[model samples]
Target: MQALRKYGDPEYWNKRYSTASGTFDWYFEYHPFIAQILDGFNSKEISILDVGCGNSKFSEILVSKGYKKITCIDYSKAFFEHLFQEFHERLPSVHYMYMDARMLSFPEASFDVVFDKGLLDSALTGELSYVNAKQIIKSCLRVLKPFGKYIIISHSDMETRKEHFLDPSFDCELRCESIVVTDNDCHEGEERLPDLTFYAYIFSKHLH
Candidate 1:
């Protein structure tokens, strides 16, 4: 599992991003759909938390559409510092914090939506794959508003992802939608990179 473990290592990502060239987005094409899903909330001014916010333009797109309260966090020193500087000049309103998904610092029920692209997938690569992923999900659940949506996009299948997110203890209802990837540029970092499609697993926190 050493290969899997590498994906969770901050140092591994630091070195990789250091050598990466132009904008290499794993979920480059998911922007429109992500925005579309968020729009389902029926409000542009909702407080949104983006976990493992890589160099993806998800938050920027939302800002363009008038999403004012966007907060993004990442543990990678490389990604955090680079995006923090870049967003400061551009998206001054979007909060970019250097934080780990497993231990979110935000107060309970602080955000209307908690969006994740591949944080859980990456965390599942560590030695404590299940524990890491569970912790991340728990933290996301804690910070979500009642009936808030936790949208996660990943290449993992139902069997792999459901067990982590489908627990009754999570106190959320789950619905999944299939996304057919048309782009030829599949992200090599993904475990299920061979497939031409991925999944968006959405967990809606209970309305209690």
Candidate 2:
């Protein structure tokens, strides 16, 4: 964490995805949790935003699933441009915005569903970890309508931080809907890291 605090900034993430040197691949799309959340929604004209929506492939999936209103935001211009160029013509219905998740400029109660895949995890590594998390949650809450759902897929540590971020006025619930365990050393050629577990949290906004 200390090491990440020293250098993990927007530039760090931008560079990670900019050159393909990092672990992320353009082919990676929405995770299982995203599909689960989408499956639970019955609304046809729901307002949705994918924070740190890398590559927009997930947004494309939402389009295929018949979601008419969708928007994606990311801080990396290179990545956003790459996704835009790849899918703009194919899925013109979805809008792409270049912005930081921690500082969103949208009206209160604007979106019915808000999803964050790995953005919070990425931001939780830097010097501004706490501040970033707080700001992102605050902005997200401001834009999320009453009775809306906020879905987050994060590392176990970040999942634990959700309680601290939730406001006292809002009644929140945390559930580990699924767990992903990756096998280490599956490939015969080289040694690999230990298994990683991701926790999915579903936050529901309570209305009066």
Name the top lDDT candidate: 1
| lDDT per residue (tens digit) for residues 1-208 in model 2 | 6675533476765665566422242223556656666767677699999998766467767888899999888888777544456556677898888887878888888898998877776677776678777788778877888878887776655447755455564455545566555554368876665755667667787676
Colliding residue pairs in candidate 1: none
lDDT of 1 at 84: 58
- Runs of candidate 1 exceeding 4 Å displacement: 19-23, 184-195
lDDT score for residue 54 of model 1: 71
Model 1 residue 177 distance off true place after TM-score fit, in angstroms: 1.1
Candidate No. with top TM-score: 1
Alpha-carbon lDDT, every model: 0.80, 0.71
